[model samples]
Target: MRTQTTPPAAPPVRATGRPGRALPLAAVLLAVFVVPMSISGTAVALPGIGADTQAGLAPLQWVVNAFNVAFACFTLVWGSVADIVGRVRAFAAGAAVYAVASAASALATDVLWLDGARALAGIGGAAIFSCGAAIIATAFDGPARARAFALFGTVAGVGVALGPSLAGLLVQGLGWRWVFAVHAAALLLVLLAVPAVAGAVPADGGSGARLDLPGSALFVVAMVLLTTAIVQGSQWGWVSPGVLGLFAAALAVLAVFAVVEDRREHPMLDLSVLRDRRFVGLCLVPVAASFGFVTLLSHLPSYLTAAAGRDTAAAGLIMLLLTAPVLICPMLAAKLVTRGIPALTLIHVSLGCLVVGDLALTLFSPDVKILAVALPMLVTGAGMGLSAGLVDGQALELIDPAKAGMAAGFLNTLRLGSEAIAVAVYGSALATALGTRVDNGIGDHAGASHADLVAARAAGGDLARAAELSGAVDTEGFVRFLARSYDSAFHTVLWGLAAVCAVLCAVIAVLLRGGSGRNSRPAPAGNSPGDRGV
Candidate 1:
């Protein structure tokens, strides 16, 4: 016993997970950053692409549209697929796919090739977002989980905020192709860290459940039809047979998908998730953002440049005030929660900001050069920022960890779907308002009314084009008239959007109430409340 007791060393304890979390966290955050950046990054390079590829507006638009449409349709699909395979595996596969597509985009010689590559990239982006959120959910817990998601939202918001400027710099310095080339390189680096990421994530290996191919296909089809209808409704006319048919088809497919999921032994989506009022309310937080925040992100710059008489640089700078909160508010909300501020309370405050901010935005005086909209812009941006990840983090906490990917996917689907719907609604409503007010006196002009053509052009902020399209002899007077019409239309739409947000805010409040006072907290995951299909 006395010999410096070299007692048998305890059997080596096998490590159950990676020794550290930093690598995996960094890897996932990098991938998440890349996807949203890609969504917004390529727009700045569009002019350069057109010049190089000899493409017209129709083809050029597809460069952006293909990505958005594909991304919107595939997120839910990828979410379901992630659970079927493994989150890490699906995430790695998506990164690989994204890298390849991005590289292909760089090497493309024509708009068609670029569009195809971008569409492929969108598919990969869907996987990355759905799986990435799930990975965070699995790898982190408690306060760490909340903080990790806060970073997740911050990075995504930063990507969206910086994409245009960063791409513009690259385009000016290197060329448009480098924009995608850089993404390819970055993703490749992310791929290199896959081993570390895999180790950190507990192996939630596949349950050997076969995918619901029929349900997946029908869901994809439904998303396609709905998104396509919204995207094209303005061009085709909302009441046109083509648009109406697409809307009807989407509803029918969705109904079929519901029926299929209801009957399937292993369905892709747990339909009950939709039935959970609190979860549905959580998902709609992003929808509020769609009308109150995203619509401004897309259209506000045009108002500043065309109506406020700001230069592009000035408008871009002003837009920063709107996006800045997105970079900071996520963490602030998370911190508040840690300090015992109920997450639901913060969410309600955020919704109030959106409504108040949208109403305050109407203070813009068409004749004043001052941006009276600054405080309102900040308030609106703060609304978006506070909920960016709070909604997601809370929603995931409510779901079984095994189903986190699906929950993430559904959340993103609503987030993106709302954006598409909101922007389309805003665009069409503005154009229609402008059209109604534009000098209806030109109804006799060649073919359809010049007023209609000019209103559309003006709505697009192509004043020169609008003036030419109007065939007005006094181009200056016509341009002024067009600007005034746009200002009036924009103000009118702001009021309408504010009203819509107020109504939605009330609806969301009721849903969040869930028949219990302000307590919006969901039950723990083991006793998960939503669709338990798979």
Candidate 2:
């Protein structure tokens, strides 16, 4: 007599219930939106925070970098934790932590306190971001997955697009603290609903399922050291003993992380994922976009308010031109993907827009036209919308569906790390260029000494302060000179970024071509349902 064979249980994606997935999707989208919104929104408030707290440029920068460091270091650990416990549990816990962190940030009386709170928020953000997409991926597949992921990306873009405008209103109407307070309140509401919306998923329970504590500790140490060195490099001098030592120490720690992961039964980062060219190419999307466009989101508002003499609200309005496409293009990309248009094609086209956008910014000048700023922003925003919409879904499709939480975490680690590095590199370059130009301008007309010029540059681009330091009688003329210097520095940065994006675009276009577009259609034989099972 023949015995009956049992098939393995269907993947958790099968358990998420199609007929009632909308509530969960909304919940996840709401959760994901908070992360980017908090990031970009806080950027708009930096100037106010600096002035109010009497903080210098370094502390202002730390407010941003601290969050990024925490987010980057802990993202993979959160991803692994989600897999060990449950995605729903992780999501709920993350929401609660994020809300509490926001409240702490709102109550902060000093820059250090705010920085610490923001870092705590980053820890929560890592959990929510890593698990949120995994929950959505578990709930949808094929065309539905494409649409869901596209919507997910779109929501994130909406947050990015709206961040400056919203922050401006909040800061102008209430105060900078209200920005943190409002998000905290909203997150509290979301936390109450997470239990019902996220439902549940299978949890792994075994020794191999345990968290990679050694790997996690090593990674955290390495990332914190790297980010600290990068952020402080300009202030400390790039070649200073302190800066060089930090970099060397970070490298050593990273080497140890690699060795630890290699010997582990289960690593925090599956190094094998690096072997997949398609995954690497998809990650390049965020790297290029963050380097080329996203880092500028925070700085541009400062430029509008300081250099152009606009108020916070006006600066925010001007940003809408750059941010609006983030809302529109992603929905369109989703429709195209549903109609069998390849995601790679959309991403490639978006990359070309990024190149054009950066080139346009390079050509802009305060003497010629102020409106020229919006044109490049529009193009770049379109690129952001189209590329950001697809990268998450396409990248995740290359990995096991059961590991979607970890996959999302890993992808974000690269993406956020790119943003952190871009901000550090670009900010340093801009400061160096601006300082030199300002010194030359001051020396030529203002008759200022090197000491006075140094003080002016250290004033963090405050023309009034710079003028006071130079004791310039023609204050208006001095401000214009400051503006011109800024324009020149911005042009230099944009030119270099444009070239990098153009080259990376060509490489990714080739990498994403033909048979490698595996996620463009349903899974093939090698990637059948059983292959994706836990």
Candidate 3:
């Protein structure tokens, strides 16, 4: 009996429609690499940046928050802009903006300057993700598109998975400034290769729709206000008037946005996509990952150092157990789908891994070894790895190719948006939980606010800062108290994340049930996915 194996996925064609098909994938991959790196990598550099600039915590926090805010808000706007201007043009413009902003970040003299530059980079990153995914969606079809998106997913996942480790290396060896400098260099290469990608697609890829100014403005304001409120809620006090006001303002703007979109001749967003229950449901895959995986990805290092009793290097290494699966799973998921596994089945499995793995991760404690938590970490990573590219590719297909940019933008908006929300929620919860524990241990005192600072610093793994803020007679005991308090908080948040992920997974399973309920797709004009899109 002969063994049967699935044939390899088809390769993406060049813009010139000839031999050498890797340019589009390579260029877009390079451009997108920096965006996620910036997202996950900057946290490692924050302390170094703060120390050098002597900036306070609030200003320092903006380095990451500002990037997230701009990235989340501008994706939809950039999606529309990409469709109007052409994907390659839009990608190049975004790369240019990112390059300049990164260069400015490398040269910044103060925290405020760095924050502004990082925000600018986020704006550029918004274009990179929305337009880059749109381009992939347009440039290939069938097996080839799956392969292209699989690689796309893998690169992004790996970028995020390894960002801190790589960024830490850079910060340690060459200083924090060099991290941004490296981003600037990588984006410049992407810019130079844009012509190759441009040639791979149709010149008239745009929908020729006039820009929707009112809708766009409203969306930016709404996302900015909403994400800002969430990011600052922990620091500013969640129930404070300012946070409440921002939430209210965001809601009002969104209400107006809905009305405006309903009335517009050409809305910025395509409402039909939103109305598609399947698309909306599938979009939450990333949202779930944000809570179950990314919250850990960005914050786990702190936990390992401060709570798990690991050193920085050991924490970074152990992180490999969680991130290693992402490197392999995108391709595995694609291969499975190509070989006839139902994508929905795989998604269900992935979500299960995230929730189940997170619950299992309750085993992680100060005395726990890597071998103890390894299985759960791998399971959680597999969950994220399976869905990262698969969900986006499947979700994008549900919409018309002409609206690929919008679809891509909206999908990622939920993705990156949920990431901001998840991280903020997780961080806030951990801080609050830790603060309460510390307050109980220390008892009532005039320096009540100082406990909050110590909790924040300790949870962030800044023991020096936490200690300095503590002003304790016995520093070692205080550190132990901080660690124990943080450990308790870590366990508490894990339970919450697991519960949230399980709920989301169940919801998504229902949404994606009955398989791809998407209307039958027409044959590609040139037998390519993004021909019309380009």
- Across 18-49, the per-residue lDDT of candidate 2 in tens digits comes to 24566667777887888888877788799889
What lDDT would candidate 3 get against the real structure? 0.84
Q: After superposing candidate 3, which stretches have Cα over 4 Å from the reference? A: 1-19, 444-450, 463-475, 517-534
The 10-residue segment of model 3 with minimum total lDDT is 1-10
What are the per-residue Cα lDDT tens digits for candidate 1 across 208-237? 688889998999999999998998999899
Predicted candidate 3 versus true structure: per-residue lDDT over 1-534, tens digit per residue? 222232332243334443344876798998877899888899889989999999998999899999999999999999988888788888899999999999999999999999999999999999999999988877766656666787888999988987887898999999999999999999999999888788766653576789999999999999999998998898788899999999999999999998888777667886756777788888988999999999998888888988767887898789999999999998998778766676777878899999999999999889887898999999999999998788888887777766778889999999999988898899888888887898788543333337766776776777657877877777777777777788888999999999999899889888877665321232333454333222
Count backbone overlaps in model 3. Answer: 4
User: 347, model 3: CA deviation in Å?
Assistant: 0.9
Which parts of model 2 have CA positions greater than 4 angstroms off? Answer: 1-12, 15-19, 44-61, 109-111, 200-208, 305-313, 370-375, 451-459, 513-515, 522-534
Per-model lDDT:
0.84, 0.75, 0.84
Indicate whether candidate 2 or candidate 3 has the larger lDDT. 3
Evaluated against the true structure, the overall lDDT of model 1 is 0.84
Better by lDDT, candidate 2 or 1: 1
